[model samples]
Target: MIILGAVLLIAGFFLGITLLTTAGFVVLIIGAVLMLMGRSGRSVGGRRHYY
Candidate 1:
């Protein structure tokens, strides 16, 4: 999800799409939250670690 968001952000920057850029940022935040939750040993599937 983060990778996808990053790709969208880069593309948006080059294409000058304000809406896409904003959506990309929103996805980035969501990805970050998911990553943080996964790293905190509270994720649904299993315990995980973040480097």
Candidate 2:
């Protein structure tokens, strides 16, 4: 998810696509939140731990 978001962000910026850039930013933030939660030892989706 994070990698995908990064790819979209870079591609969007390079291609000058405003929509894609906005979507990428949103996805990136989601990924970051998930990552933070996981690192804090919280369960993701109530199933698996990130570590």
Candidate 3:
């Protein structure tokens, strides 16, 4: 999700697509939160690992 977000963000920036940029930012934030939750020993969506 992080990687995907980054790709979308860069693509959006270069392509001047506001929608993609917004989506990428949202996805990146969500992915980071999930990763943090996983690291803190919490089960994210019943999964031990997010990746």
The full ranking of all candidates by TM-score, starting with the best, is 3, 2, 1
Off by over 4 Å in 1: 44-51
Candidate 1, residues 1-51, lDDT tens digits: the string is 788788889889999999889889888888888788887776544547432
C-alpha lDDT of all candidate models, in order: 0.79, 0.84, 0.93
- Count of clashes in candidate 1: 0
Predicted structure 3: lDDT: 0.93
Clash count of each predicted structure? 0, 0, 0
**TM-score between candidate 2 and the true structure:** 0.85
Q: Residues 1-51, candidate 2: write the lDDT tens digits.
A: 777789899999999999999888888888888888988888899845542
> Candidate 3 lDDT, tens digit per residue, 1-51?
999999999999999999999999999999999999999999999999898
Alpha-carbon runs more than 4 Å astray in model 3: none
Ranking by lDDT: 3, 2, 1
Give, for candidate 1, the lowest lDDT window spanning 10 residues: 42-51
Q: List residue ranges in candidate 2 displaced over 4 A.
A: none
How do the predictions measure up, each by TM-score? Answer: 0.80, 0.85, 0.96
Most TM-score-accurate candidate: 3
Q: Flag the better candidate by lDDT, 1 or 2.
A: 2
